[model samples]
Target: MSKKRYILSVALIILTLNPIFSQNSPKTEILLVGFDHLGQMDNGTPSSDIFSPKKQKEIIKLTEKLRTFSPDQIMVEKEPSEQKQVDSLYKAYRENTLKLSEIEYGSSETYQIGFRLAKMLNLETVYGIDHYESTSQSLLSSGKNIDIFKNGLLELMNTARPMKKKVQQDSLSIYDYIKTINQPKFIDLSHNLIFNLPAYVINGKFSENGTNTVDIGKIDEKYIGAEYITLFYNRNLKIYSNILNAQLDHNSKRIFLIMGQLHIGVLKDLLEANPNYKIITTSEYLN
Candidate 1:
């Protein structure tokens, strides 16, 4: 082909690939802010009383810190099906018609952090992206000759007990404890607790010449431990899906997700792997 023809052909090819290239690039900046549950529910973990004047003030401070990110959308750990209820409560709160003490909008993080942040940013609605699967620790103890696995879990709990007690005894504010938990070391530890512990019990106990007896009972126990871990993973996967399904403006959307600290490690990994998102660390905002 002539020089002009060749140049025009190349230009056309570049033009054709431009949209695909852009599509592959990151468009959204997601700040994954993992927070402890605010309501102090009976979830077998230490719960914070966020209703105190001191904790409330700290929450305000936390909101002020998060406001610098100027997130366009705030996502919470509530299920997607609950969006209508969340939107309704948010609207009422915005209008000064709903009291925080009201049963409809309790001290839950969805209301405390997510709703408060969205209001601070002047956003109309907060998004709910949680998916729940009934999980039971008893499953790990169900099969025979599973005492090793049970003991391993007990040991893990004992490991975490001191930190929990120290946080309570040191009089660390809810904000301070949350900040500590979001740190890299703590996040890594949380990840291991969820992913590594199960694998250790399953692989170490069930492998040939392992600690546990190589019998049908041990195999079943190993499978039970694995199933328990799988439920944890599946719940996080669905939560990530709900995040993606949220209706967000592509032009200038920055999403801030407020979720339980336990969900953060897996969700962060999933978000980091997606090309459509640029994961923003909590340290960047909190610091």
Candidate 2:
């Protein structure tokens, strides 16, 4: 082939391969910020009152730090079905026509963190990516020799109680408390509490009374503590799906996900597994 013809052929090949190569590149940087429920919503976990002026000021400073990430999208732990309602409120808030505190929205991290950050960044709207699934406690009640499971759960709560109390009693800022909870040490401990509770039952920790024996033949049919953990996993998976469904183009789109602290562990695992995303820890930005 002539030199001119060869050059033209090379250019066409590069054009054809550019998109394929780019597709393999990670374009989305996601900062998964695990936060406590500011509204005190009942999740069997301790809650805080974030509506005070001092707390509000702290939140603003925290948002300022997060703004350095320059996120293009902010995702909150609200249900996907509530996106329209959230968007409406966000739009009003951005226009300065609606005050979030006047409308019973002050207690939620969604408004305090997500909405505040979006406004500070001059973004249009915040995205809600929450999905709810009820984890039935009836399983705990039904098993014959389930005292082991009950004891295990109580131990787990007891383990977490001090940290919860410290946050409230020590007068730590909401940002500091969240930063502590999202640390790798805390995340791993939390995961162990959830997974180990069920494992205790499976390992026959309650078998001393002969009442703790789970029917091996009917294991799949019966409800167990592990199933409770699975429910939480499923919920986080659905929330991740909602995050993905937002359909942001994978080209350097920075996503900030503000969610309950417990969710951080699972969501981090899921996001880390995806090639399209690069996970950013709260420590990286908060510091």
209-250, model 1: which lDDT tens digit per residue? 322211233244545556556767877888888888783433
Which runs of model 1 end up more than 4 angstroms from their true locations?
1-24, 41-48, 142-170, 203-222, 247-252
Tens-digit lDDT string for candidate 2 (62-173): 8898999999898898887887888888888889998877656566888978888999999888887888654433444435446665665566467566666665553567
Error (Å) of candidate 2 at residue 31 is: 0.8
Error of 2 at 171 (Å): 2.3
TM-score of 2: 0.76
Off by over 4 Å in 2: 1-23, 41-49, 136-156, 203-223, 247-252
Q: Please, what is the TM-score per model? A: 0.77, 0.76
